[model samples]
Target: MGQVREGTTWLSVIWRVCNVFMSLFFALATYVQINDPDAGMWMVGYGVPSVLCALISWKPLVSEHLAWRRVADLHVMISSSVVIMLGWRIHKEQITQIFQQEEGREFFGLLLTSMWLLLCRHSGRSAVGKLRVFTAVAITLFPFITWFYYHVNKELRSEWPSHCKTAI
Candidate 1:
């Protein structure tokens, strides 16, 4: 019992330390994106919410004084959704504009980045829970990713989407 308490206390301290850095990281990202003219509305719009989510989810005082796990889960889900939507909207532009990546490397990086977007979520101890999270993410993201790839293909049908219409 004492050992469990000690370990939990140590983990809480570590979480607090991590919270500080994560808050800073998200804040910086938010500020930079908001100030960047070329980042597009989608990116800039989600920036503030992202920082708020990060700060609220990880702040020890907020967590301790409130329904910590519920709040954390809610914020994490919102932040992850924002990230995935932004990625879906701009994945093509990013893949094309980024530093020289030989051929297939860009898509590989995109896949990895998409997978890593939800690492903050403590997806529970059960395999079913973890699998559910991954499955949900995949289901939500796969369509956009597939659309992106298909649209990018040189031989994709010209009838796919009209240039006059935005993808929404």
Candidate 2:
């Protein structure tokens, strides 16, 4: 029992570390998205960590010896995948232009959906619970929040007109 507890604690620490890295990555990506639409390379900074966390978390998640951690790790994996996919889409020239042409409205919508999915994964209940409610609220307000930010950021406004529309 003691050994199991210790292992669980260690896994939890790793999970928390991954979360911290993810938060930083997101912050950096958001800054880049808002300030430097041309700096598509910045997406890799967040993508790499998100993929690494998902991969590292996979081992414990699949181990029969650590069922609880496995479930938690699965959530992390899903979250990471969502982030990676979104990042990839944003970095692609064609997709990125589509997003920019639309004034980031679609991009923000997708981001909100992904975030809500992530929140659902984190929300402790295996089934429906408060987390679901929170996800609902997030999904509902995601577009509005994104639009608000888009309007507030001058860089977003100025760059849209001159950005390339060529599909990747």
Best by lDDT: 2
Each model's lDDT comes to: 0.42, 0.45
Report the lDDT of model 2 for residue 82: 57
- For model 1 the local lDDT of residue 61 reads 44
| Minimal lDDT window, size 10, model 1 | 97-106
TM-score against native, each model? 0.38, 0.31
| TM-score for candidate 2, residues paired by index | 0.31
- Error at 108, model 2, angstroms: 13
In order of listing, the candidates' clash counts read: 0, 1
Q: Compared with the true structure, what per-residue lDDT tens digits does model 1 show for residues 1-168?
A: 897777655555444444344444434434444334344543433343345335534653443333545645554555456556545645755655322232232233333323323343442222223344345445435434654675576354343233212332
